[model samples]
Target: MTTPADRGRRGKDARKRVPRSSHAVWVPPVDRPDAVAVLERQGRDRLTELLPIRYGRMSASPFAFLRGAAAVMAADLASQPHTGLTVQLCGDAHLLNFGLYASPERALLFDLNDFDETFPGPFEWDVKRLAASVVVAARENGHSPAKARRAAQETVAAYRATMRRLARLGELAVWYQRIDAERLLPLVRSDADRRRAEATLTRARRRTSLQALGRLTEVVDGRRRIIHDPPLVEPAGASDAAALRKIFSDYRSTLSEERRLLLDRYRFVDAARKVVGVGSVGLRCFLVLLTGRDADDPLFLQIKEARTSVLEEHLPHGPYVHPGHRVVAGQRLLQAAGDIFLGWMSGPQGRAYYWRQLRDMKGSADVAGMNPGALWSYARLCGTALARAHARSGDRIAIAAYLGSADTFERAVTEYALAYADQTTTDHATLTAAIAAGVVPASPDV
Candidate 1:
């Protein structure tokens, strides 16, 4: 495990090497009988028990199947020999998770979004996931494997090259900043792409507190209310409402004294159980809207269900994980700008995750709908953003050293992406069959 001080130190101190003779640790093969058994056992269809499963499923559409595909691929890739440079990885590093967002200073920056499977594991784990997603998403968008593979190689190449570049620059440059969108655009290939990037930037510009107010709070009967569509109730139930308030009350303790003081400016205004994300369909996720003083002064917060990371059960662990801190700690380590209101607390009702700002000009690049030219642009962005995130938590030099200059790493990831994509098709088939047999009832909508 890396200490805060150890992580802060320059160079090799930040990263630890994982032995890679193909025999250092036992990584399971997903195609093996045991691995298949584990997936089925872990898989479920109940809304709560299956929320993660659904999250994975919904995340696997024409535009985005890669995010939901990580667990399946992780099970497959874990069976392979890796360089074992374990650092905190976003776990799911698809292009969609890389998006344009406004930094606190109001600068439009791009960064990693999802981190549920984040853990200190082989950095390549993040790479393979990104590459495979590039392929899967590209194929969905009608790109040839030749194009997709090249795009995948581009992603692997960018991660390796950037890490090496940052490694040479030393720790300060890696930690003190990120590759902003302006610096990022020149890497994209097409005129359509440059235009699309500009449009996303335009959207990001439009994401602010004032815009956030429209999506979260609305005037109903002349009183402001957070929108709700039953089952995902707004305001919660009477007694449950009070308990929800209590949860937020305790959540304040997780923040620093300084942040807590900043939060004093805002008071809870409205809260409700919001059905969010395809995967989180059944778990309890609450949306809390806050007001600074008057009704027009608004802010939004989300309290989601935090479950055990899939990485916890499979990979060789690094840090001691207190269940209460899983989401918060993992997120801070994995994302560049996590929710300022991000905090964690556990209750007898089970674990609930609290975060702020549900929407802020937040939108994903549509990979499935993208032209082949745009897929390359999108893949590179996700790859670079993910690498930037890893460089923050671990030593870049050692990692860049392990990756080397050859196409060896890119070849390895491309090979793995193909293998895992096959495994996902097989698993998806099994899931499809399970639904057909009525073992897992198919939602007519799905």
Candidate 2:
């Protein structure tokens, strides 16, 4: 049997792509359920369909380009080197995707922030996406192409070193020891970096379930309710509310006996329709407020609508598991420590999506204005983290063997990222043209 380590030792050929079996599961097109079609459609409906994909509409000119370029980039990325080592990918693990959050013990934790489009697929796919993100971010920040290339090269280089280092570590050591905020201090480079790091730690320390409950829960005329704001969210309708009461019964079956028993103490006070995320905009998401003893003690849960992974069609299907279940589990596997309330369940509409605390001290790194060195450093961290994630799931030894020396993979990916960055530019132009022609509604904010 070729263990991952043994494969790593064999040198490169073993890691080469083997013939793959056909996809096992059938995922619907992005156009499924009518809502996603707008995004899938281009030209006539291109800009309009592009709205949900863009977050914070006016945050930056480049973000609009990024959103518009997804379909374009996905088509391009579908054409890269694939390491059949499938695990839940962050789908978009850019520098911005990493953030500070609280562990169950309330310690500050920094890890991957986004997971939509997460599914089993090629490991290189993630590195490619992240590298492109850096490029896009660089372009937005007015960095020259040479600077962007430097950032990408450094990131890929770091990824190679990190994977090689982890490959040598005791398996248990690699698995158990995480770079938590508390322990990650040794990695900081400067006083300025340390200030931001310490600030994140301070914020993470203040986060708790109590904070999630405080921000999301409220009492409405003596009935506990999860607050709602229009377009963004609204209270669940009477009919759906009734259905959730029944579904809650079934949902209980999915939890552990103890968790079900613990939940039994709380009454499902109120539920509301909520909208969330950029790529996931318009997908069904909801907030459910559960109270224990009285309205004062509360738990806030966002029951997001999960859909088939965007990667499912592009790559072979992974092990059989509920999409929502796959997300929560994959996330746990990738992150050192995930949100304590990180759990999965099906909802009233029968639509699938994962849910978790909305805030929990969530804050990501600032990518714009970063010097070439900082960008390189940041890329290294992202690549290293991504490598660790892959190693945890599949045979890293085989991967290391295949990767051989970091030089080839790094060079190949840099070339690929550079070419793809050009493609992204074209797609952005396509979107901009569409917006001008009324093909899509381009918001100015993001």
Candidate 3:
């Protein structure tokens, strides 16, 4: 067994291969793949009709482009030198990806919520993506470049500090670490910010399945039926519904025995094909409504298609071969507490899909409208949450030692973030140009 001292030495030794100071550099390779081409490749296997919506959403802003261009960023990061410290990355850890969600115990916790592109890779990749997002968001919000750099710096500092703190704790203590939503109020300085935070939490609590039932379903012919919103949300056809029912049991088998018993109590009522997220717009996604006890008690489960991680081609293969299983396993390992219904199963045509509650008190911050102070605070919180997640799956002791007490890594990452934000801006423009030139179809109204 490696001792703590040995672990510390290992982290320190990594600096020789990739010095912490080297992280600040960001010069895109001359032969970097065209951003639109990368996005088009991702759309090939997706629902072709929905591809327009994806391009339209991503073309809205530079940050939106970054959100949808994980493939582009993944390739860029792979070309750079890294610390070689591996962790199960939240592969697309942009600002909006960190959010508030309920634990199995019903407590509200804030953590990394998206895992579609999650895979094992150098830990710094997640950090760089997150920092770059902060800069891009800050710029879009009209903050000065200096302010953007500061926000990104605070983010990395919080991550480094949190990692070091977690390294000093016992294994179980580190595993149990989490940021509770109630604690967020005290972290805010002004009453206005505190009230806003409280309101956000309250709003999230109201986003339960029962709320969704009222908002997304209506009584027709004495039965609760999912409301159709056209291309965004439409009822599944007879054949699609039949396929869902067939695979329901296989998905249930992936759950724990107790959870399976609990799931058995609910009767499947309806299914719908729903478009979701910027990057996931074209992917096959479905919403399953189940009723427990009575019609008023509703449970909405989302079955989303899972593709190989954007980082998969850049790094070594991970343990799980099945894409759905990979997403489910990564979520379980990285989350402080996971959903009871988290599961995976092969769909028709051997497509991979993962299942989870559609909404259980989940909410994300509106980064676009946030002031500089608010953005910095939120960015730091995201950084802390990310460190806690990484500590659970990677060598915290080594990472902490590598980061040290100095702010060198933070400063370097801030510099890289600003540079990468420029790249994202350029990439966003490229996509917009493609849409303008009729090279890509986009539906901005959607």
Candidate 4:
């Protein structure tokens, strides 16, 4: 087995090839429209009827636009000088994507909650994506450019600090470390921030499967069934339901024997094609409702389609042939504790999907409404969370050495974030133009 010391030595050797100071440069490209076009093409395979809703959400603001343009940004990040230090990336890492979720022990843990675009890639790619998000979100919240830069800098700085701290620890220690809800309280800067965090946690605790059933389903002749919400949450056709059952069975085989036994108690009742998130709106996402013991005891599972990661187009080919398997593997590799039902399946026509609980104490940051102080504090927390994740999969010692004690990497990343934020605004305008010219279809009703 490769020991932690061996990994640290390897990390030190890597710094000799790519110095940490080299991270501080950004070269703006002239051919940005091509990247924008790539994003438009990515949406081609999605559900056509929901394309309007996807575009409508993306067109709301530059931050929202950036969230939907992961493919575009992935292409851009690949062009930069990468260190060749690979980690399982949260390819679409952004301010709002990190959240609170229940771990196996029923504790609320704060970490990266979205992994739709995960793939093995350079560690810096995740950092740059996150820093750019801070800038974009700050702009969307009407904060000054100086505050935005500060927020970005704080994020990078926190990552640097956390990585440095982790580099000195044993590999097992790093792997075992986690940021739970109680630990997250110290990161809050003010009393108002504390109250907001508490409120969010309180709300998340109540967002259970039974709660979702109460809100989303109704009793028809004493039988509860999902309500239809056109273009958002609607019943799957008979043919699709058959395919889904097959996929669900295949997914069950991927789980452990214990989990399978636990799952066997629940009987699948109904499923709906649900529209979710800015980028994933047009994709095939199903909310499956299952009941155990009685109608009062419900379990909600989400089966989301997984395509080849956005990063895969730019990076080398991954080991897994099935994208669903790739997503599950990446999530397991990075998360300290993942969902018990985490599994993958191959569906009809070679479509791939991963399954997990729909909601169990899940909560996310509201970046668009955050003040400067709150944004700064949130950036630090996200940075710390990200560093721990990277340390588990990448060379923390080498990354820390490359970053150093000085503010060199932080300044460079902040500069890159500013430039990228500008590019995001320009790209958002391109999308808006496409919609206005009827080159792209969009709906406001969503």
Candidate 5:
């Protein structure tokens, strides 16, 4: 077994191959794939009718474009030299991807919520994506470039600091680390921010299956059923519903015996085809409503199709062959606490799908209009949460050694973030221009 000193030396050795200072460099290669073409390729297997919604959502703003363009960014990152310090990356670790969710113990925790693109890769890839997101989000909030750079730097600094701190701890101690929602309020700098944080937490706690039942279902002819919102939330057709019911047992089989027993308590009520996120817009996603004891007690499960990670194409093959299993395994490995219902199974047409609670007190920060100070605080929190997650799956001692005490990595990542933010803006323009020229079909702001 390698000692701590050996791991530290290994990390230091990586620097000679890819210096920390090299992270700041960003010049899109002349033969870089067209951003629009990449999006087109990703959408090929997705629901064709929903492709317009994806394009429309992505065209809303530069940040929105970045949110939906993980494939594009993955390719860009792969082009650059990296530290080669591998971790199970939150492959699309943008600002909004980190949020609050209820752990099995019923405590709310802030962690990475999206795993559609999760895969093992260089740790710096996740950090760079996160830093670039901070810059884009800050710019969208109308902050000065200096403030944006500061926010990005703070993100990397917090990550480096947190990783170093975790590295010194025993294995079990590091494994138990998490950012509770209660701990978030102390980090706020102002009364208003405190109130906002409190409000966010309160809102998250109320976002339970019961709340979803009221909002997403209605009594139709004295029977509770999922409400129809057309295109976005429509009743699954007979064939789709049959497929879901047939695969329900298969999904349950993937869970532990206790979890399966708990799931068996709820009777599947109804299901609907739903449109989810910007990048995941066209993917096959369904909301399954189930009732426990009686109609009043409810449970909501999301069955989302899992595809090959964008990072997978750039990096070597990971351990899992089943994409859904890969997502579930990655989430379990990285999260300090995970949902009890987390599982995966093959679906109709041999597509891979994962199952999890639809809304277990889940909430995301409304980052749209945050002021500079607020954004910086949020960015730092995300950074810390990210570091905690990486420490769980990666070599914390090695990563900490690679980062060192100096802010060289932070500064380099900040510089790269600013440059990539510019690239994101250009790509956003390219997408919107394609929409205007009728080169790609885009439904208007649905």
Candidate 6:
């Protein structure tokens, strides 16, 4: 095995490909499409009827537009210089994507919770996505320009610090490290921050399957099934259920023996097409309800459509032919712990899909309401989690050495983020203009 010192030396060599200071520069590609075209291209694979809703959600705010424009950013980032460092990127590693979720051991852990666009890509791509999100989120919260810069700086600083620390530890030790509520509380800057974090965790703990059961389903005609709410949750055709069961049986084969045996106890109840987040509104996503032992015991699985990652256009192709397998594999590689029932399957029409618990104590920080101080603290937590995730897949020693002891990389990222934030605003305005001209259909009332 290579020593940390050797890895450090190897990392220093990366400066030749992309000098450390070169990272500070931001040059928009001349061939980049107008924002409308990017949005149109992304909607091509989506459900035609739901594309308008997706546009509406994205048009709500600049931050919302940034959230849904991961592919657009991916194309831009691909044009930038990189040091050739790669990791299993969350691909869409925005601030909201970092959250608290229950592990199989029932521990509420803080980590990257989204992986729809996960793939191997330049490490800086994830960092850039996160840093720009800080600025966009801060601006949305009515923070001052200085505060936005500080938030971006704080996030990258935390990432640097965490990576430096992890570089000293053995690989196994670093892999075993996890951040839970107890570990996260001390990082808070004040009593109010602690209370907020605790409150969020408390709220998440209450969001079990029972809570979802009460909210999303009701008894109809002596049967408990998902409720139909137009443009959000709706029933599938009666014939769809049997086909899904057949498809799900194939999903079961992908699970471990113990998990498969455990899952055998639950009987399928019903499934529904559900509209989810801003970026995923049009994709094929389903909420599958299952009953175990009795009506009181319920399990909800989210089956999400998986396609070729946005990063795939820029990065090399992975070995997996099934996109669902790529998502499952990337999630396991980046997350410290994952759902017990995490698996992948082929859809009825042969599209790829991956399944996991829909809402197992899941909670995200309310970025819109955060003050500068609170946002700074939250940024640090996200940076730490992101560093840990990258360290798990990339050479921590090398990346840390490249970052060095100073604030060079952090400052550069802050500058890049500010520049990118301006670009994002311009792009968002283009989208707004297109919508006004009826070029891109959007319905806020929906």
Candidate 4 to truth, TM:
0.96
- Cα lDDT over the full model 3: 0.94
Tens digits of per-residue lDDT for model 6 on 190-255? 788889878998999999999999999999999999999987898876766777888988899999
Query: What are the Cα lDDT values of the candidates?
Result: 0.65, 0.63, 0.94, 0.87, 0.95, 0.89
Candidate 3 pairs with clashing backbones:
none
Q: Point out where model 6 deviates above 4 Å.
A: none
Candidate 2 lDDT, 206-257, residue by residue in tens: 6644676677666678765666766566788998788667766655665667
Provide the lDDT at 319 for model 2.
Answer: 71
lDDT of 4 at 268: 82
- The regions of model 5 sitting more than 4 angstroms off are none
Pairs that clash in candidate 1 = 28-79, 54-279, 55-279, 60-65
lDDT of 3 by residue, 41-146 (tens): 9889999999999999999999999999999999999999888888889999999999999999999999999999999999999999999999999999999978
Per lDDT, what order, best first? Answer: 5, 3, 6, 4, 1, 2
Model 1: runs farther than 4 Å from truth? 1-66, 230-235, 318-320, 348-352, 444-446
Model 6 whole-model lDDT (C-alpha atoms): 0.89
lDDT of 1 by residue, 261-283 (tens): 87889887777877665434565
Poorest 10 consecutive residues by lDDT, candidate 4 = 27-36
Error of 5 at 441 (Å): 0.8
TM-score of each: 0.85, 0.83, 0.99, 0.96, 0.99, 0.98
User: What RMSD does each model have against the real structure?
Assistant: 4.6, 5.7, 0.7, 1.7, 0.7, 1.2
Deviation from native of the Cα of residue 71 in model 5, angstroms: 0.3
Q: How far off is residue 210 in model 2, in Å?
A: 3.1
Clashes of 2: 19
